[model samples]
Target: MSNPNSLVEGWARRYGRLEARPSNVNPLDEFSGLSRRLRGLRLKEWIGFTLLHPDWYSSLIIQDAHYLASSEIYAYDRAAAALHQHAVTMRSGSMPMPSALFGHRYTAHRGDYSIEYEFDDTDGRHVLAIDIAETATAPAISGELHLDAAHAGRPLSVSSRLPGRRSRMYTHKAIFPAGGVLRVGDREIVYRPERDLAILDEHRSLLPYRTTWLWGTFAMRAEGGVVGANFVDRPEITGEAEESCVWTPTACEPLDDVVFEPAEPADPDAPWRMHSADGRLEVEFTPEGRKEVKRQLGLFAIDYFQMFGTYRGVVRGAEGSYEVQGVHGVCESMRARL
Candidate 1:
């Protein structure tokens, strides 16, 4: 078999810009046609969320992995400079795919810990309800969050084929108005709809044995309107299907190649600088706190970093320019071999 990375690079060199499918298309139907080039090759899926508020940045990650299933909940309090995290993993675990892309429920459970990400539509607007339960650990953390799609723009959806094989990857990202209350031990943090927002990430990819990627996303309120973006720097795997874009209240604008520069690459909480080749995106990130994970199970290993930060810069697009001022967000870098 050919190396998936090499095939993706060559494909990108030959065909510059990859086209994305319409958001209404079903990803599972697209996956059904692929011929598994190698047995035991993994098809991974996950539902990730980030809710940003003035005083707290909270996130929930649920992975429907084949090698190892896991769920993680994390929050950073800016005022007290405190971090709370809870996670659980099970080897050789798996989850069923959602019945449909738009209105479906996805879940992950292990022992006394469980997570659910349910999606539905209410009067033409998208609604997502997230619930987490962790009854096994001390100071156990749990919560329910409600998010509604408030932007008028279409979501950024990419369903691209890999080179030299039938493998593929599908990604969907969007920003929404969020509100909720999280119970952390004896304390509670509330997210107000007026000031808080959430970013939703849904991914399904049939990947090779080794892969790595750098990704950053943030959403903020600007004078123009609500602004959000998703940036990824991993051409070897994704090629021109970068899924990088600047989202506005009116539309989603595809972005050219982007670059991520960290003041201290080794530091999980280091400040970051990001820019696009087209000179449309220029931003600086100052992190308030971060969560790091290092895990190894048999032949699988991963090193992940998720940082909570505030963004200060400008995002120029076809509609207009958005001035980002102290907007709470998140950025992540990860490498894994499974």
Candidate 2:
């Protein structure tokens, strides 16, 4: 197992300039294998949908759910293990447009669970609806989350070609003040309009057989305004182009590489320290809860751990410095063979 952080230094110098992509650009339009000559090898695409609240975090994922691949639909409560459920479905063939992982209108149904994801406007506002019936492993959960992103403004998007492969990775992240209503069995949870926040993570990539990455993100209310951060260390990217940023209400500031160090690897609730090389961002994350998933099936396997906690430290932005204490969010480390 090699360290992924070692692959990010001098990334821009070796790979050239990493540009800021437009928020309105459709990722499917930039497929590297669009030409007729390279269509045979274009086989991977996926989307990860997430909703965050102060008390809990919910995720609905449709990975390769539209094409000739083994698509998976899973929903989980980040704070509780009793609310996790998943199902796998196999598609017969492949199609180009209106893809469940990329297009504006996407929906999929498997067993008694169904999910729909849509991009509503150019400003990164979207909707995600998930309905799950009671299963043997979890209770019934249903919600229609409306992410009105007027406050978080524009998104931070980046695209890059994977080295030594005919593939590209495009990622878009936007954080906004969110409000919705959820029903879990007989209990109802209401997310007030001005009291909650959510993050939209849209990832479309053509990846290799073996992939590994470390990712961390969070959004919370500050004294004056809102704050958000996205950090990643992966083999497909490096240098100034790495998807790292500190987001404010007015602007998004690109950050240098970040390093994640855990106080103890065996402890899921261990404190983790995160810092940037340029001294612009620093924080200590103390985990309050965690969600762990492990799946192994011969040639394909995934091991993922996500910790929810509060950030206590300071972050310097363009306007001024802001102190963060007891701000809620999540941090994760993942290794996958896809």
Candidate 3:
């Protein structure tokens, strides 16, 4: 599906800009010896995951970022207004790159967090197991989520080379049915396939020195079926690969650039409005709470905010229009110099 000598870029237009499930393409083979260069030190990779239930919000994020291994866990109970957050950072090697190609197995250990993702060919699903050992400072969080990829449709997988630099990036986004029992402290949050969903955002990119982007995603029931979306706005995306799309029960509908308008520029908990440039999508997000991170370590700096919220919107596609009513999801704004 790609030329050997050329950097893999863009999805096939005929395929709705969606690649086949379980892609075999590996970016490492193309990145090769570039990881040792000064420019390559800016490369960033991470896996951001979200599990959605009706009344609960949970996220486990692992980053082999720039030159540090970092992980975070955030869980919130909307009814009780309870929030649990823990983050740890350590100097370590980069995350396993082959996991993006085939997803055989990979693990990241940071402080008390141990996160693992393994693919089981027998059942054609990816199992995500997260174990956070209880310490004097925090409680334990353990869960094993089974992401049913065998039945999920194709994913939005795209690759592109930067315009004026040697930087390149590969990103994969998929929404699939998932069920699990996540225990946080003494409370148990259960997810059933019939009513819950999961969204996986995986990225392995050789980024520039400074990068910024606005990203939003959600999965929920709408119009008698399930519909999910991934909207992103990045200036470096030279149109060779537009990684924005709406995932329906049948196909992934490709979308043009999306605009994010915040009611209050600096407030992460404010209501945000989003619309597609072509007028095919419009949504309003009202955030309940946010996990905000701002830190500066010498030459490295990061200001990131990811807000958990509910979305109300309309998405017009070839099949029909999907209306989402107060569905749970997340939106993020990030600016980093790594």
Candidate 4:
């Protein structure tokens, strides 16, 4: 077994920071150091795409989104695969989200069904759009979603190095009002800026061959205000401060490490409890639906499970305390051998 304290210290020496920075910094440029400065070292690059709403959550993920992982790139529609279309509804007793392994494609640059990022001194934004004709498992789906810092406020970003590997993790989370329309055949779910909230979970990393982590994020209306949070626990995250924080309309409050208690048997429908050591955050997650994918290919495999659900809790910040009730979000557990 590894000494947890020693692992954390090692990470802090390489990646820990004392403060937060704005999200406008280009992640591609930040992570380019090792690859650019050194030769014959391995690097993995990709952008995850996600769109969240009160009624549902949709994702069109393009791993190796930029074809930076290697000289050759792949795009396929398959469970536990890198590129695919997925969606989950939030209704009570709702069925699992529809996932189809088709209409998967990849581009090296920003274009239709591609992930795009732009940032400058004045603003920053990341956009993802996809259009899939009707498939065997679901209806036609199309939509465009972007996270705009000019409108949503600055995001929280973290950049760190992986232990014992010539790799790094650069990630950012932006929570803001999202406006778009996801048309599922004839049923259109419009995301109005006045009512809907969205979060952007952008990550690019070159991880070890085997990795495991626990992550959860929530965004919703609480006590007449908007609240959003991102929390994670992984062995590679050795920094003194984990990538955890709570975002309000006006400010982002950095938080200490969080503790998660998954129900025994790890049932998807069971209530998962989470809280912070300082007593600043506490919540009970009741899952409505889940997306589970398991893939095994000789030496490489990925077992990923994400639970979409509603949260009820209390969050204390510099401004005050906010009560969160029936707010929709996601919690995930992943074990992977890359």
Best prediction by lDDT = 3
Residue lDDT tens for model 2, 232-328: 7667544426677887766678778788888897887789888888777788888776667687867677798776667788777889777878777
Model 2 pairs whose backbones collide: 11-239
Backbone clashes, candidate 2:
1
Q: lDDT of model 2 at residue 252?
A: 72
Ranking by lDDT: 3, 1, 2, 4
For candidate 4, which ten residues in a row score worst on lDDT?
93-102
Model 2 regions lying over 4 Å from their true place:
1-44, 65-83, 86-89, 92-103, 122-125, 223-225, 236-240
RMSD of each: 5.9, 6.7, 3.5, 10.2
Q: Count the clashes in each prediction.
A: 0, 1, 0, 0
lDDT of 4 by residue, 1-338 (tens): 11122212322423443233422222233334566434112334434444566666554443441212211111222222223243321221121111111122233232222232332334454444556555565556666654454667346656666665555665656676667776655666777766676676655555666778888888765544567777776775444346778877677787776888977554668988888877878988887666776768577677988777778898787888878888877888989776
Runs with alpha carbons beyond 4 Å of true place in candidate 4:
1-42, 65-127, 146-148, 222-225, 236-239
| Candidate 1 C-alpha lDDT tens digits along 41-119 | 4767777888778888888877756666777887776777888777777664465555345566677676656677767
Q: Which of 1 and 3 is the better model by lDDT?
A: 3
Give the distance in Å from residue 260's predicted Cα in candidate 1 to where it truly belongs. 1.0
- Residue by residue across 1-338, what tens digits does model 3's lDDT show? 43222223343212123344334443444444545455446667777788899988888777776577787888898988877877778774644645433447767776668888786655477888888877776678888888887666447776666544766766777776788888888888888877888888788677766778899988886544568788988775445667788877777788887999999987767799999988777999999988889999898899998899899988777788888889899999889886
Model 3 residue pairs with clashes: none
| Model 2, global lDDT | 0.62
- Estimate the TM-score for candidate 4: 0.72
Per-model TM-score on C-alpha atoms: 0.83, 0.79, 0.89, 0.72
